[model samples]
Target: MDHYSFFDRDLSWLLFNERILMEAEREDVPVMERVNFLSIYSSNLDEFYRVRMPVILALNKLAKGGKQEKEDVLLEAQSLIEKQQQKFGQIFTSKLIPLLKENKVTLLFNEQPPNEIQSKITDYFFSQVMAFLQPIDLSETGKNFFPENNRLYFLVSLTLKDNSKKTILLNIPSNQLPRFYSVSSDDQQFILFLDDIIRHNLHRLFINEKVTGCYSFKITRDAELDLKDEYHGDLSEQIEKQLLKRDMGMATRFLHQPNIPLHTLHFITEKLSLQGSSVVEGGMYHNLKDLMGLPVSLPGLRYSRWQPLTNDQLIDAPSLFEYIAQKDCIFHTPYQSYNSILRFFNEAAIDANVQEISVTLYRVASDSRIVNALIGAALSGKKVKVMVELKARFDEANNIKWAKKMKAAGVEIIYSDKALKVHAKVALVKRLVDGRIKYAGLLATGNFNESTAAFYTDHILMTANPFLVREMELLFVFLAKKAKTSAGYPIEFKHLLVAQFNLKDRFLELIDREIENVKKGLSAGITIKLNNLEERVLISKLYEASQAGVKILLIVRSICCIIPGVKGMSENITIHRIVDRYLEHGRIFIFNNNDTPEVFLGSADWMNRNIYRRIEVCFPIYDQHIKTEILKIIDLQLNDNVQAVGLNENLQNVILEKHEPLIQSQQEIYHFLKQEIYDRV
Candidate 1:
C-alpha cells in the first residue's frame, strides 16, 4: 500500500458544497445571510451537475470493477444529495420563513397571495407577466420545443373538455422578469415567487379545461463546451459557435417538484430525451438560487457592512508610479479598496512617459475599467498588448466581447492557443523616464475584475522591481507566439515561478528543502492557502515532508484531495476551511526557511489543469514589509475559531472549538489593515 491516501476530487468538492449547506443551517448566521448561503448552495450544486456529474456517470458506465461498485457509489452519492435537499426544505420552510415572518415580511413559498392582495396580484399578472409568457402544448407533434439547461419551467397538467389529460410546458419567465414579486397590503408585506404567481393565475389561461396540477421542473445539461477545432479557426468565433450549443449537451439531471403525476413525469422524460438522467424529487421551487434577489437591507437580518479601506500611500501619492518605483506596495481587496490597482492602469493609460503596456486577462469583467484604460492607452498612440484567454469557461462571451472591443481600439489582442491557457494575472507598463526604459508591474492572486474585487478576497501587488517586470514582458512576448515550444519555451524564468516550466520543480524543491531542514533538527514547516489542491506530485511531496516531521498547515476553501491526520501517512498535516461574508480566494505559500520565512502569492492552484495545461505565474515576495503583512494575515486566519473549520481524516469539516477570544479572520484582517493605516497617519 502507498504511504499516503487521497480522496476523490469530485466527492471532496461535494463535501465543500455540504459545508455551504451547513452554513445555511447555522442559527448564529444572520437570517438573510443564511438565505444567501442557501442561494449559493443551490447555485453551486447546479453547476456541479452541469460540469461534473456527466464525468461521474460516464466513469460509472466504463468501470471495469463491475457496474455494481459504481452503482453503489452512485446510490451513496444520491443518498447524500437527498438528505441535503430534505435539510434545505426544512431550513427554508421551517426556520427561515418563520424568522422572516417575525420581521414583518412574508415569502409565499407554496401558499397563495393573501385575500387582501388577491385583486392586485390578478392585475399584476395580467399587465406585467403576460408579455413574457410563451407556453407550448406538448401535444403538438412537429414544433420541437427544447428545454434549455437549468431554466425553470412548469408542467401544467389539465383535464380537457374530452376528459383526456393534456400537459403543457410554461416557462417561469425568470430570465425576462424578476424571480420574486414583492407587494404590500396595509401593515403586512408579502414576497411572492413568479412561479407561485403563475400557478395562482393558471385557471385564467385554460378557460375550458380543469387545471389539475402545476409542478416546477428543470433539466440540467452538461456544461462541457465542444471546441474540437477551436485551435484551427478564430478562437473567439469558435467559442461563440460553441456557446450556442452549450445548453443542448447531454442531460445529467432532471429535477422536478414532488407532486407531479406519474404520466406527466413520463411525458417530460421521454419528450426531453432525458431517459437515463438522474431524476430528482424536489420541493415546489426548482431554482432557489433566485433567493439571492431577496432584500438584504432588513435590519438585523444581514451582517454589518464595513467600508473598504484605502491605501494611504497610493491615494496620497502625487505620482502613483513614483511611489511604486520607490518601494513595493501591496493591497488586500474587499478589506482594502481596489482604487489603488485601478489607479495603476488609469495612470499608465495617459502617462506621456509610458510607451507600452502588456497584460494577460483570464476573466475580464463585463464592464471593465481596466479594458477601457487599455483602449484609451492604445488610442493615445501607446502600444497596448493584451492576451485574452478565449477559453475562460462561462465567461467566454464576455471575454470575447472585450477582446473585440480592444482589438478595434488599436489594442493588440493575443488569443491563447487551445492546448495552453495563460492564467497569469500580470501586467507590465514600459516607460521611457529620464532617457531610461523603466518597467513597472502589477501582479495579483485573482483576476483583474473590479466587480469581483468588491467581494472576492485577493491580494494585489504593485512594484517597480526591474527583474520581475522584465520577466513579465518576456512572458507576454512568449505568449504572443502561442506558447508553442518543444522544450518549455527555451527562455529561463528566474524571478517568476512559471508553470509548464519551473513551477512544479521549484515547489518540489521547496518542500524537499523543508524535509531536509527537518532532518537537520531545524525549524521546518509549510503553510499554504489555496482554493483547491489536487495535483498528486506536489501532494506526495507534501506527504513526504509530513512524514519527515515537517508540520504542514493548509487553508483550502474547496476541493482538497489530501487527507489530513491519518496515522503514519499525514499525521503532521492540518487543513482547515474558512467560509465567511466574502469568498476566501487569495493563494499564499509560506516556507519556514529556518525562522527566516519565504512567501509567494499567485493565481495558480495546485490542480491538475494548473500544473499541466496552463501557464500560471507565482511570484516570490522580496519586500520585507509586504511579506510580514501577508504572514500576519495568514496567522490570523490560522487562529480563527469562528469561521474556520478543521478537516478530519473522513474529509468532514468539523467546527473548531472556540477559545477565550474568537478570531474571525476577515473581521480581524480589516481591523489590522485599519490599524496600519492609522499607524501610517
Candidate 2:
C-alpha cells in the first residue's frame, strides 16, 4: 500500500499563477511582454474565482457538521491571491511603469493627465465615451440593482447643494469600446484607461450635483452552469438556457477600490445582500486585464516575433493525402505552422476520392477554416459527421453557432452525451485510393482552433497507419452511438488509450511494467508532459515505481498535486514546469520499456475529470522517426533551465540553477524544427 500526501489542487494552481507573475518580474523579458503577463495573471484569477470558487463555496455549504476543511481551503486561496495581487501592484507600479516611460509610452492609472493631453482626453471622452454612459441612482433602486458579471463599473458619491448626498452606479462601457484609449501628444504617446477617462468626466454627467468620489468596482459571479444530470431536451438547448442563467448566478467576489469608505462599502454590500467574505478590496482599477490591449507599438519593447515554420513534407506536396500516405507527419505548433492541419481538411474537402469526413469539435475558432472545409465537404456530397461538444465552458455559444451553421449546410452534427464531454481532438478522413478506401486521420493534443494554435504549444499527428486509423474509426463510431447505449457497455481499444474505458488501466499497467523491469535489474524510467497531474491513483502508481527505483520526470504546466523529491515515497521523481511565450499545452508520455521505449501523445491529462469523466484519447506514436522527434523535443524541454522551475519540497516554484548556454526550450524547439526543415531540403 502506498501512503500518499497530496498538495491542495487550488493551491497548486495558485502556485502556477505565481510562476506567471515571476515572468512579469524577469528583467530579461521585454517590457510590453511583462505587462502582458500581468494581464494574463489577472485574467486567470478572474476565471479562478468564477469557476473554482463555486465548487469551494458549495463544499463549504455542505460541511454541515462544523467541518471547516473547505472553508480553510477557501481562506488559504484568498490569502494567496491577496499576496499575488500585492506583488502585481508592486511590479506594475515600481517596475513596468518606469520601463514604459523609458520607452516613451505612458500608462496612466489614477493620476491627473498631463497638460499636453488634457484637452485631447476631454474631447475624446465626449466624442467616444459619453453616449454609453447611463448612471443608475442606487439609492432609488435600493436592493433592486444587479451588476453584470465581470463588467467594470463605478460607484459614485454625489454631493448636492442642500448638504445631502446620493450614490449612483455607472457602467464603464469597456465591452462596447476599447478599454485603453491611445492619444499622441508632443511626440510622446499616452495610454489611458477607460475607467480614468470616465473618472475625469464624472462631473459632466451630474451637472447640478457635485461628484465627490468615483471608485471602480467589478463583480465576479459564479460561472458554473446549472445543467442537471437528467434532462429531457437536447443538450445544446439545455446549455443555451444555462448560459443565460450564468450571469445571474451567485456573486463569488465583489471587488471594490480599497480607498472606498467603510460606510459606502457597507451600504453597497447591504444593498446587494453580499456576505462579508465575498467583498474583496482591490485596486483603483478593477479590470487590469485591459493592459493586454495597451496600444504601444514600440519595436524593442515587445518580444521579437518569430514566424511559424512551414512543414517541409507538406510544403511542396501536390496533395496532403499523398504526402501523409507516404509517411506520417507531426506538426509542432506555434513553432511550426498550423497550416498543415488546415491543409489536411482543405484537401479532404476538394479531393474527388474523398468519401467521408469525421471530426470532433470541442472548442473551435470563431471563424474556423476547419468548419468551412467540413461544410464544403458536406456540400460537395461527401459524408460529413461532426461531433460538436456544446458543453465546452465559455465557448458553448460559439460551438453551438458553428454547429448550426454546419447543420444548415447539410452536414451531420453529433452532440456529445450529456454525461460526458468529447474532449478528444481527433479527425478521420476516408478516401477511395486506387479503388479501395484508405483512412487518413488527425489526432492532436490541442483544440482545432487556429487562433489558439498560433500561440499554444501542441502536437498533431497526421497518419495513414491502418492500425491507428482503424481504432480511430471505432472511437468515432462509439461517440456517435454513445447516446443510445447503456452506461456499462464496454469499449475495448487496442491501439488507443481512451478514458472511461482503458486509459487508466493501461497507464497503471505501463507503470507496473516499468516496476517489473526495475525489479529484473533492467533500466526503467517514465517521462510525462501534461497540463495537469492531479489523479491520486496514477500518482500512487508513480510513487510505487519510484520506490522500486524507477526514475520519473514530469513537466506539468499547471495544477500538479503530486509532491516530488519526498523520501521513501517519490525520491526518484522530479517535476519541472515551464511557462514561456507559448503555452505548454501538449500531453506526451514516454516509458523506457527496457531500452525499447514506448511514446504516446494526446489530449488527456492525468486528472480525475480528464480520466474518469471526460471522453479523451491518447494515441501511440508508432512511427519510430516521429517518436524520436518527440523524444528530442522532450529532451530540449528537460534541458530548459531558463524558463523551467523545479518543484521544491514545499511544492514552491524554484528557478533551476542555470547551466552553460542558458537554453530556453521554446526557442530551442523552434530552431530544432527549422533545422529539420533545412535538413529535409
Candidate 3:
C-alpha cells in the first residue's frame, strides 16, 4: 500500500482559479485581455459553486458513514474560497481598475465625477437605462425580493424628510444592454459599467420617495437540484422543468457591499431567511464576470486573434475517408482546424458503403454541423446510433433539443442509462470496402463542438486500424444493452486500455513496473498531462512510484489534489498549470520504463468519475512519428514562461520567471502546425 499527501479537491480548484486571477493582474496582458481573464475566473467560480460546491455541502451534511474527514475538507474549502475572494477583490481594485484609468477608461461613481462626465452619464441613463428600470419597495410589505442569479442590484437606502430610511431594490439591465458604455472627454475616453449608470439615476427612479443613500449588492443562490423519484414523465422533461425554477433556488451566498448599513443588511438577511454561513460581504460591483463579455472596439485593447489553420492532409486529400485509410492522423486542435472532424462526419454520411454509425454526444454546438451530418446519414439509409448524454449540466436543454431532432430524423438514439453518464468522445462507422466489412473511427479528447474547437487544445485520432475499430464495434454493442463490455474484443491489445474492465488495474500495473525498474537502478520516470487528478488509488500508486525514485512530471489543468515537493513524500513530483490563449484540454500519459518510453492518450482523466463511473478509453500511441510529435508538444508547454504557473507546497501560483526566453506553447504550436502544412504543400 502506498501513502500520498492529498490536497483537498476544493483547495486544488481554488489554486487553478488563483492562476486565472494572476493573469488579470499581469502587466504584460492587454487591458481587454486582462478583463477577459477576470471574466473566466468569475464564470469558472460560478460553475464551481453550482456543481462542485453543492457536492461538498452535501458531503458535509452526511452522517458519520460519509467520507471520514468530511468536516475538515469542507472547512478548508470554505476558508480557501473566502481567501481567494479577497485576492480577487484586491486584484480588481488595486491593479485592474487603476490600469483602466491609466488607459483613459474610468468606472466612475456618482460621488465626484467631472461636471461634463456626470452630465453625459445622466443623459445616457435617462435615454437608454430608465426605460428598462423597474424598482420595487422592500419597506412597507417587507416582501422577499428576488433578482436573477448573477444580476447586479442596488439596495437603495431611501430616507424621507422625517429621517426614516427604507430599503428598495433596483436591478441594472445589463443582460439586455451593454455592461460598459464608452464616452469621450477631450482627448480621454471613459467607460462606465451599467451598475454605475443605475447608481447615477437612483434619485430619478424614486421620484415621489426621497432617496437618502444607496448601496450596491447582489445575491448568489445555492443552485443545485435533487430530482425526486416520483416523477412519472420523461427524465429529460423532469430535469428541464426543474431547471426552469433554478433561478429561484435557495440562497447559497448573499454578496453585499461592505458599506451597507448593518440594520438594513440584517433586516434583509432575516426576511430572506439567509442566516448562517450563506452571507458574504464584499465590493461595490457584483458581477465582474460580465467584463468577459465586454465588447472590444478599441484598436489595441486585446491580443491579436489568430485564425485556425487547416490541416495539409485534409486540405489536399481527394476524399476524407480515402486519405484516412492511408495512415493514422492526429489533430491538435485550435492550431489545426476542426473542419476535418466535420468532414469525417460529412463524408461518412454521404458514403454509400457506410452501413452503421455510432457516436457519443456529450456537448454539441447549437448549429452543429455534426448533428446535421448524422441526420443526413440516417436519411440515406445508414444506421445512425447516437448516445446523447442529456445530463451534461448547463447543456441539458440543448442536448434534449438535439435528441428530439435525431429521433425524428430516423436515427436510433440511445439515451444513457440513469446510473452512468457516457462521456466518451468516440465515433464509430461500419463501412463496406471492396465487398468486405471495414471500420474507420475518430477518437477525441474534447467535444465535437466547432465553437469551442477554436479555443480548447484537444486531441483527435483518426485511424482505420481494424484491430482498434473492432473493439469500438463491441463498445457500441455493449452500450446498446447496458452489459459489461466483452473481455474478448481484441485479446491482443498490447496498447489500448478500456475502462470498466481492465484500465484501472492496467494503469496500476504500469506504475508498479516503473517502481520495479527504479528499484533495479535503471532510469525510470513518468510524465502525465490531465484535466484533473483526484482519484485516491491512482494518487497513492503515483506516490509509491515517486517514493521509489521515479522522476514525476505533471501538467494538471484543474483540480489536482496531490501535493508535490513535500519532503519525504512528494519530493520527486512537480506540477505545472497553463492558462493561455487556448484551454489545455487533453489527457496524455508517458511512463519511462527503463528508457523504453510508453505513451498513451485518451478521454479518461485521473479523476474518480472518469475512472470508475464513466465509460472511457485510453489508447497507446503506436506510431513513432505521432509519439514524437506529442513529446515535442509537451516539451514546448513545459518550457513556456508565459501563462504557466509552477505549484508550490502551499499551491501558490508561482509564475515561472527565471529569465528564460519567453515561450507561449499555444502560439508555438500554431506556428509548428502551419509550417508542417506548408512543407507538405
TM-score of each: 0.98, 0.98, 0.92
lDDT of 2 by residue, 137-188 (tens): 8888533578899999898999999979989989999999999888988778
Of candidate 1, the 10-residue stretch with the lowest lDDT total is: 64-73
Compared with the true structure, what per-residue lDDT tens digits does model 1 show for residues 521-575?
9999999999999999899999899899999999999999999998788999999
Worst 10 residues of 2 by lDDT: 482-491
- Best first by lDDT, ranked: 2, 1, 3
Error of 2 at 625 (Å): 1.1
Instruction: Spell out the clash pairs found in candidate 2.
Output: none
Q: Which stretches of candidate 1 lie over 4 Å from their true place?
A: 1-3, 64-73, 141-143, 229-231, 485-488
Off by over 4 Å in 3: 1-3, 58-79, 109-124, 161-165, 185-187, 228-233, 483-495
- CA lDDT of each candidate? 0.90, 0.90, 0.80
